[model samples]
Target chain A: MKEKLCSLQEAVATYVHDGDVVAIGGVGRNRAPMALVREVIRQGKKNLHIVGREKGMEFDMLIGAGCVKKVSFALVSLEEFGLAMNFRRKAQAGEIELDEHACNSVITSLRAASMGLPFLPLRGMFGSGVFEVSKNLKEIECPFTGERLAAVRAIKPNVTLIHAHQADKYGNVRIMGSPFEDILKAWAAEKTIVTVEEIIDNDEIRNNPQLTSIPYIYIDAVVHQPKGAWPASCDSYYDSDIEEIKAYAQAIKSPEGFQEYLEQRVLSRRD
Target chain B: MAEYTTAELMAVCLAREISDGDRVLQGLYSPLPMMACLLAKRFHAPNMTYFNTADVIDPEPKKVPFSTAGPALQERAVTYIPLWQTFDLAQRGELDLIFLGAAQVDKHGNTNLSAIGPYEKPKVRLPGGAASAHLCAIMDTVIWIPRHNNRVLVEKVDFITGQGYLSGGDAREKAGIPKGGPRKVVTNLCIMDFEPETKAMRLVSLHPGVSLEQVKEATGFELIIPSEVKETEPPSPEELEFMREIDPKGVRELEFH
Candidate 1:
């Protein structure tokens, strides 16, 4: 085991690489891994793909930092903070491949990945336009239903980055607010990087099993990073810093402003 | 005239309309109307049965957020009814009323949820038909509300989320729908019903203080406003208080949708 103070660059370099599908946990403004994402951006990994329901600063940084090549999201806006200009403009401009979606599609997609099944069977989509949107989506016969169903396929990512409330040095993490579908992402990935706001002893978390969100067995590295979910919340630990989020929103509205943001927070950082 | 945001108006709508005597079902994230149903039951509908044809309807109410439950909702509540049950309820004609929102609706009540742009790749994508398509096929009555304007009340939906007003006379029966579809559309601006022949949405009523032209301006589709259009009744003082105070979290809608 190695113990050393790591910059954001060193921290992100520990998990990500090119051509990886990343499963992220966070909805609206709760439970995100912003610091880790900042590290990923600062390190400049490439050809990344992301899957999730809500797209927060993590998605923004990935795209803005020129690391992401594709994204599949249920809903990727800031909700009330404003629309997602980086993702929206990038998708519209074709800089990144976008799969704009609904819950059934994303959740089914994740489930299929976990089951190692080729497709997911569902009712009510024979003639609907979703058939077209998902035309490229693999279609197959549901083994049990015998009816034709769509397979979301296994989306094993190279890494899954998550921020939670507490963790032991061994990587067992506890998430307080919303887990969104993170456990599946962990199972669907090759490796995981768990960062936490607090670092507790493994024995303590082991004694009380209910507090655990990520069991240590699946985790690769455990990093103690407070305010790790900077733009988002860590639940019982911290709330979203709306002021910083507001500033990020203001910057992403224009390319010039976004570039400035990248330079100031991303490029300027030693990490 | 009050300071009720769009969200508050939606809460009031749920509280006043849904009754305890009737079982209520709603869509997820459909905050205002769902709240309105709870209030209506708490105040009016006393014995109403609640159902969520989509997700598990959690009655405990604390862990689930006011708007929509995250993954944690599964932890607290038992998965109760399947969507087919709501369809069954509508099929048996047991449903007193059901509320839903629409992308676009035309005269004679043809609603679209297919594409926001062309049929190929739409500009905007919404959560596809929940029970709208089937509900239209069998429901005794359905209320369509769109929070936004003109783009929604178009002469045609870039896509149809659900097929509405299949046929006023007997076309629905012939098509296999026991009951005809679509009773009314409650929008942010005003209310509308179907015409006799064309079956297009006719302006039937407006929210309090809304004008005829204002409703007309918001509609992309041509509408027939009845000579005598009424206003949606305002929330009673009691309804307002319950919504703002007791159910501020918007739980009334969460359990059923």
Candidate 2:
């Protein structure tokens, strides 16, 4: 018999662990798993490390909820209107240990891990400041040309929390918008969990097999949550709510404002 | 000749330089030239390929910033391919165009994105470099430096985030990269190309609103502006409307980071 599927809270609860690196999918205010983020807040997750790639809203929510202990990312902005106030304050205050990695390096490391590779050859540090932090890169001589190149270590995640446009009961999912670095993260993670806008039939997926990006076997659990990818646009499904994003940006800057904001939308009103 | 906006200046570069049907790869946040390349594909050559860092290849790429037609973009007729496999395409010399941005671009086309003014404690920290460094050596890359001030176009970048013109294709070969160095450099004020023999940069054309003095003064190094600078074209009525209508939800503003 198939196991019982649960709510967004239960789904995220089952996977997250303290001090674990989790990759979140969404950009600024679009397609982030806000419902589950609320659950993280409710649980009061501690020592959680977040890996963000254009995942502004979810990161802010977790920080607002005091969930993340450390963060590694490229850019953490609230999509255009302004700064990720709460996140910025936390980082500046040394509340969270922040390791600012380059966007391509993070994704490349994840991509290498996803492919089950030990490391990847990288050359993104040519004319930039990112080259400094990456001095740890190991150099090896290439067999083909004998030219030495640096290898960036792989990035493996403890868990992957992805929001998709559609998914099947079997766990195959469709990412309706920009994949960002989601595919690479899926490979790098030990376990993958997803919140999807809709659940479709496996037969439907089989009928049109190519559309699926997240293969079924990799998924540990799939939660059917509508509007799950909020803040981030899900193609034609929905446009991002700008007012909500602005409110989030404002709320994150101040603890009182953020707590009040979260209490009003997420904690006070039940999902 | 009419005065051209920055968008048109970028478009003129692409239309004039990119061959009739060369595969072009552009990364995200590469706005000005990306818009230009897409416009070229729509108007000049349909066979031209378009690839986004998100990994969609030649997608009937949605005009909207966040693509709505994700599934349709991967359909058979679209020649949808793996995004990471793009490196392979460049390795095999299948790419002709690649659009990139630089925080600080020097006379040699070297780019910097490490620190602001100083090495450790800088005035402003910028987002570190992306694949521009790697891609710079692979494809017929085009560098876009939107801010055309001396600080941005310097005599030498503070750090080499991406190489501009390799000593030559010989340096690229020694490095095991099959392709060559950057073919052109696109800026807000003027367009530039390398002096092949010495690998020095030479000015190709200046944007309409920009003057010879402004272009020369803005550059960190002495430039060889052509005797006759052609005016850049203006955005079509359609292009202007599209820029406004889509992603009105602060899509443009969300790019501060």
Candidate 3:
């Protein structure tokens, strides 16, 4: 049994390497592993490929920090607040490659990887132009039905980071509500790092084994960091820091503003 | 004549479209549709199953949260679904009605939530298509646009996220899509539905104070208008009170603003 427990800084330093395709788990402002994401930015890791379903704060921060080179996911907006300014600006500036997929397609790729399959067939991308752009997606005929369907190649990330409500000493991770691709992402990645708001007793995890979203067998590292999903809602813990997200959305509108934001918020926060 | 904001009116009109025991789906950042789902449950469709994009299935939250992913929305959810399951159900054709918003909607009802310009060099990189491509291919889609204008309602979308009728007739079926497609498009100004013959979006009814001329001007392409277009009825006092009760914080006002 490997001792999976560690600090957020150590976990990011050890597992997340440069140019690694890292998947951060969350939907919108929910359960985003922002602490580890900020540490990744602070470490100056470059050319990282990021994957998420509905990426918001984590991806946007990484993109703004110039840490990400490519992104494969659907819809990177702040939901209601507006578009992800950094992601939008950097993507448009050609600074980063945007391999956009339907939200389902992103999950399909993850699900394929998790299932240990070469590719997964789906009918979702049949008519959409996504098939035309996505190099990994090809149109193939179903053997039985002979119907044309989209076959997406498995996307196995080098490492994945997920935020959860609690985890035990042995890293049985439990997410309070709406796992939101974290479990699937963990299963799909080569290495999975979990950041938790609290680290409970192993006995507590054992008593309710079914409640555990990710078992210790899958999780590589468990980082105990309270408010790990700061600014993003942590479900049953605290509400999203909307004012900060809103300010970040507003300030990231310009190059200078974005720079100031990165310096003041991400870079300066050594704690 | 009663006074109600366009958001409330849209909610009321959308609620009317949902029937009893119909399973409804709403996407992220959809406050109006979320309200409509709640209203339908309270009034006509109590047995209806409602699911939000955030994976909150049959949520019975006290107040509608700012985002579907918010904690409030998950206050008393029947179950939690992953993003994968949401699409899985759609593919299996389990979901009946879906409420979606689009950046641009075409005459044929094809939607664009992808980008404003070409894929390579976009003038505006709008949020890329989520599950709209799949949901639109399978289930009955109800599009609600808070802002109605020529730019929003185009002759042809820059890109098709959710396939409406494609090129009309059996185009969707020809593309190997499932039976259902865009059923209605409720906007601030009017409610539009696809013509049975051509699948072109037709002006079904104008909102109160919204003229047919105004709708035509706002629409990018020529619309199929009935000779006798009726005005959308204002939300009744009871309906308004129910809505206000459902949303005490006036969160719906944010969308209109």
Candidate 2 residue lDDT tens string, B38-121 = 566666666787776545666543444532222323333244344456765765677787776777877767777544666444
Report model 3's TM-score to 2 decimal places: 0.97
lDDT of 1 by residue, B154-214 (tens): 6655654455654344444444443556766666666566775666678766777678888
lDDT of 1 at B142: 52
**Candidate 3 on B1-257: residue-level lDDT in tens?**
55788889999999988999898887777888888988898888899988886687888888777877788887788888876787787788777898888999999988888788987888888877777766777779899999899999999898887788988888887888857889999999999998898999998899988888899999999999888888888888888989898798887777787
Question: For model 2, how does the per-residue alpha-carbon lDDT over A183-209 read when each residue is reduced to its tens digit?
Answer: 667768998888888898888889988
Candidate 3 lDDT score relative to the true structure: 0.86
Please state the CAPRI-style docking class of candidate 3: medium
Please report, as a residue range, the 10-residue window in candidate 2 chain A with the lowest summed lDDT.
A123-132
Query: What is the C-alpha local distance difference test score of each model?
Result: 0.61, 0.65, 0.86
Candidate order, lDDT descending: 3, 2, 1
Over 4 Å off, model 1: A1-8, A135-149, B1-7, B14-148, B159-185, B192-204, B224-230, B242-257
RMSD of 2: 4.6
Across residues A1-271, which tens digit of lDDT does each residue of candidate 3 receive? 5678887788889999999989889888888988889999999999999998787878888998899999998788888787788888887888999888877888888999999998898875656666667787888899998987888888999999889999987889998898989999999999999988889989998899989899998899988889989889888899899899998888878878989988999899953
Off by over 4 Å in 3: none
Using DockQ as the measure, the top candidate is 3
